[model samples]
Target: MGEWDLRRLRVLRAVDECGTVTGAAERLRLSPSAVSQQVSALARQLGAPMLEPYGRRVRLTPAARLVLRHAELVFGQLERAEAELAGYLHGEAGEVRVGAFATAIAGLLVPAIARLRESAPRLAVRVVEAEAAGAYGLLAAGEVDLALSLAVQPGGGDPRFVQSVLLSDPLDVALPPGHPLAGAPGLRLADLAAEPWIYGAAGPWREITLAACADAGFVPERAHTAADWTAILAMVGAGLGVALVPRLASARRGGGAVVRALPADLPTRRVVAAVRTGTQGTPPLRRVLDALAEVAATVQPD
Candidate 1:
């Protein structure tokens, strides 16, 4: 086979995904004829048929499937090469932008950036305050190099990004200082079944709270819905209702709220750092990721 054109391979992959040259053209923002030309050229170069007519659509031939299986690996390797070359060209002097929630900014990114300043003086780190649910969008759009999020579960995540768990932040119950269970030991989620709850109006935290409550055999009567930790803790402190506060946010418990750990088996918010797939190996990104992991290791609930 002659030297394969990466562009043609990409076109073929798009056709395989879309199942039609017109669909692939729309996806690739090219004319259908151009899409067909690319795939045809690729097939000619490889001396095999790449696609076959299937009713009104098209399907990949056995040869095309075999080629795609290798093409995917080649594409991934090229991405890695580009990332590594960028790192090499920039040395250790490039900037790394990170998007994270407020608490993670205070608890993780801040400390990580501080460490990087000492260890990699030329590498600048920028932070954007983004919630977990929306952070991935920023990452996908290339607005951020790293995104600290809670939405990516262990063993399951978007294939387009590489996710690494920074820490599992346990959720503790926060109550008013004078609440009956303020100093209680051996507390469990079931024990709070009757108490009014304060949780996020929507988002992963809200889902987690509801799911944990349901697993405890009852639904919480939500007396207040607040997304900010400060507001939630404030409500708890005022005896309005109890709230499930993650350890990462416990540092700002403020006055009148008492935080207590629940049973060891309770759910924990998994804080993960995600980078664009194949970019994690770059020196600047690797350094920053290491710094984040180091900071996360020492993070303790206050």
Candidate 2:
């Protein structure tokens, strides 16, 4: 229709890939209003609404879906062009996509990304936030070039993929500030048995936390479940219930919560990089792992 319409298509593509206008705004670093306006502009250009309602989510109209496919092709071409340019300037080209857990984002990935930006300036990276199992699934599905995941202690391990230990951290119990245990020097496993617990979302996490409690001599009574580390910590801060969290998650939380070691007798969770056994072995992938190594080195205890 017009030049503005073309820009709108890019907005549409961003929204579709990001899953929400809010998500698109974050990626583009644009205001939510800007994102919404672009999508609406595209509808005007098409002379009809291209996004229809489907329950609470928006469903792409047929025309919009067709446009989306073309957007993907355009994106692929853009990637190739960038790669070609990089290859012309250097010996390698391409981008790496990575996924990691919330705790790792704070404890590990931020510094890694910063180092990668400074040292491997030529490499392009896309970071996705997800849990351990999801990170592995992304690795298997080729949705990510690298996955930073947690190795649940003593569980057999993933047979189909390759793993390299990135680092390990102990898990601890978080109690709300001013709680009776907040002022205690240390707490034992049995001490936590009767406390209402905050279990990490149902997955290997549930098993790991439960197993730690079991090692302490009693199974913790579950009071709630949450996937979001912030929410879990916030709840703990509020004194809704106590939670067992990795040390990293406990770092940023200050809402009257006290963290205590879960005894020296238990196993710690090891975070690692899982790369699918075989892939292109691209430069972008290697750069990411190298950056991660740099990040790990800084945090490892001497």
Candidate 3:
């Protein structure tokens, strides 16, 4: 054991990786002689030869390799520490960008942000409206710190992200004001099997709707296809077709459409928040996630 200086250890690692003093100097933005001197001092401190010549390049001695291995671990831990410190400093006074679908933006994201403004005034929340898949992409690409999506299993089990289920948003049936099922307290999805259907864009929602309908022994006649819940509801209100709507998305009924809950086991999508694995430790991100959960809890699932 000896007094190990990180600076010297870095110099040794650089020289080992670069294969020459000049190469190490260039990488470290130092003169070649300076790099040599640092390595020399490190050799003296550790009481062991740290480098060996191999042709025109340099190689790490057995002892130097051991030291460098440990040095890498130390450097990594230090980097993580710095990141945590930065997170703490910025948690209450920094900006966090979020990606979410339109309905989440309306029913959960916006309200969560408003709550953040009141509680953490210095923390600014930026939002981008995107669907679940797109939002998850943004999160993976580092374009956003957090994403609100219906895809609870984001990253498909990729270890790079942490997914938290914020809530289970249930799917409801949208009916026109004078429709036969408009006033029903609880309706079986099978009962509407014969009705014209306005389905969402082809994706998870459509899959759930189709699966539920299939379980009910019928296939909905796709009369309209719209991505936006409001648009879907409008189509329903015009008596064009009935559609399945997520409760969070239908916070405000449009086009004179009435929302009716389906049977308990029908269909529901999990509202999940996906973040870079280590970002959940950031104070600001944690605050925003908490606020989202709080707001989501207040939503009365139809």
Candidate 4:
């Protein structure tokens, strides 16, 4: 046996489908003799009988039937590959894995996904909820194409990645309903200093909470620790403690918690997108970045 010829296999499958050399040739726009010759070459290459004569036409031998079955799969896969390639070339489709914090996934990525589906229906986006540092780790490890992180990740001069500021997410205070500071017209971080705090899971957000409190001249008294904004808000609602929630995370403040803005000069986390240095120019990635920017634009930064 020699190397398999895809052309010969195609011809063999065509013959099996059409049930005759003449019919296969008509479908393939080749002479019946050429079709018969292709099938003979295929049989010779495989060292097996391809077709057996029937009453008037010809039928595929068991060996040929097996080859045709596999050939059909090959052809189908090639067709799919071609379609996907076309999508990549047009910037309308491809898989983009995004690693982002939970807050950004809800406020930014979720909205961007809706737009992407409408604008590039064939594009596929896989999102992973990760903290700032973890998201950057995944980006560096090649597990994710884009990472949405806070300034705490600090990719400033890293040669391995290109970090672009996506937005500035302001921190807000989540107080229990009817708490002393809830009635105040203008809230300052200092006002909540004496109250017990429900801090977020250890990461950039928790760091932000601590730093904000330190700037306000007191350390927060922690009564609860949670990774989820909802859980933190619920604890605050129960009067367990107050919490520092990002604007994006507390947009729909409820569960008996009242959200208040910090002073204009107070701290806000710089949300950013990080991609491999050379990947920013990729068509699909470019589209995803553009969509993220569009979504971020809608947020009113403090």
Candidate 5:
């Protein structure tokens, strides 16, 4: 048989639905002769009779019934494809991969994903836990659609990525419960100058801790080194030393420690979302970015 035209298949299905050439033509707003001509053309193309005389009207032949059954499935699939395409065009569907640090995975990305479940249920999000430094590499390599990272120096960020600030997460001091300044009010980073500090041995958190301390005029005496927030908090709780904890991680401060707010001049780390320079405007990427911002707005420092 020659190639089947979808328009002819549609006309055949309409005839089956309406039960007569006149009725199908009236339903389709075409004249009865045009309807008969299309059906006759389709029959010739398929080398089979599609209609037969049945009393004063017409009935489908066996071949026409089989064609209509398969045509129904084809039409259903076409509708589904169109719907999916519409969703992709509107930023409501498709997959988005994101690279974020551990704290961001918990504090921002997870919440943003939850919000997307309600707002864009068909949009799939895949997450990679990566630090600020590595996330940029992932973004550059196109391994991720978005990257949640700590803000780099002013005018020092990569030109290949577009960055947007998500939130400013304050850094608070986690002190052992028995420490002299455990619950101190009006606390300042300078007050902890002489205290032993527990911090990440490397990564952006280490840089943030060291930089904030330097701005306060004293280098913190390193008492322990740990990259995991839970481990650092555990060490602080065990009286191993105080640690600078970002508000983003404060919620996980397990036990035996007191998290205290610093003076109004409290130090903070800027959290940002990054995407490939020009691709930030992409549908799925933009939807994920907007969701992150919405979730970030609800994150308050305790």
Candidate 6:
């Protein structure tokens, strides 16, 4: 409690585990007397004895046991804090933690990463491929600095945080290559109303898709209740059924499926960037976000 060195906590825990001053000192690489002195100093600081005699070895006093439990937890957390801070200060091109949803990774984040590699060769951009709905959560908790997420309309997520709408890419229906709609000029959601579909209801995208269908006048016949667009499209490629997907689905090098635009009416989904509420827009994060925006701009809506 008196701003004692962390070593005092370690000495206490080691002695508790090893059950002897000599053994604890050996584990900590300190002399037995030093361990004794440190423990005694800690006891004096706390105004209580932290150890109890037990046969040839020593056991913890009730107070030592209680404090040691908390000490272990505190030390573990402190170690993590130290490592994260180390990564933060790590050289000129330190690691930047980023989190994004899966489709975003395939959509624009991969290109963003490539652009960052080309422009800032030294910056280590650490990416975590997490669910899009969870991306903002990661940013909120300080687990990540930036998040790439999706919303039906721009500026809808975390108004208290900074959001940059990168692209308003159109969503399209992906069908098997030889399917009847493959060569069609365009489609309306009602055009495929009778067709069984596959989708994930884990996020707003699910509700957005379903609500869009309702507005079109028919509830979708869910052929598959699944997550992960790759698997969803794989099911589509198998001709199992068709599903709605974003434009990036076309970026794949053919042979998978055909993406056809929705008829002139349906709203487009806005893909955006969400940075912490007040990042001060440092040059490093600014440069990274700019590179991200540049990548998003290149994503032509098919």
Tell me, by TM-score, which candidate is best: 5
TM-score of 6: 0.63
Residue pairs of candidate 1 with colliding backbone atoms: none
Worst 10 residues of 5 by lDDT: 152-161
Residue 24 local lDDT, model 2: 81
Position 293, candidate 6: lDDT: 85
C-alpha-based local distance difference test score of model 5: 0.87
lDDT of 2 by residue, 15-109 (tens): 77777778888988899999888888788776777677766666678888987788778778988898787763452445778888877777787
Q: lDDT tens digits, residues 72-110, model 3?
A: 999999998786667557666578999988888988889
Candidate 2 lDDT trough over 10 residues, lowest sum: 152-161
Stretches of candidate 4 off by over 4 Å are 1-80
lDDT of 6 at 144: 86
Residue-wise C-alpha lDDT for candidate 5, range 129-225, written one tens digit per residue: 9877788888878898888888853313667878899999998889998898876677888988999999877778888999999999999999898
Per-model TM-score, in order, reads 0.68, 0.65, 0.66, 0.73, 0.86, 0.63
lDDT of each: 0.86, 0.74, 0.83, 0.87, 0.87, 0.77
Q: lDDT per residue, candidate 6, 197-220, as tens digits?
A: 888865867876787778788888
Residue pairs in clash, model 6: none
| Preferred candidate (TM-score higher): 3 or 4 | 4
Candidate 4 lDDT over 15-109, as tens digits, reads: 87788999999999999999989988788888899999998889999999998888889899999999989998777889999999878998899
Model 6 worst lDDT window (10 residues): 85-94
RMSD of each: 17.4, 18.7, 12.5, 4.5, 2.8, 11.6
- In angstroms, the error of model 4 at 173 is 0.9
Rank list by TM-score? 5, 4, 1, 3, 2, 6
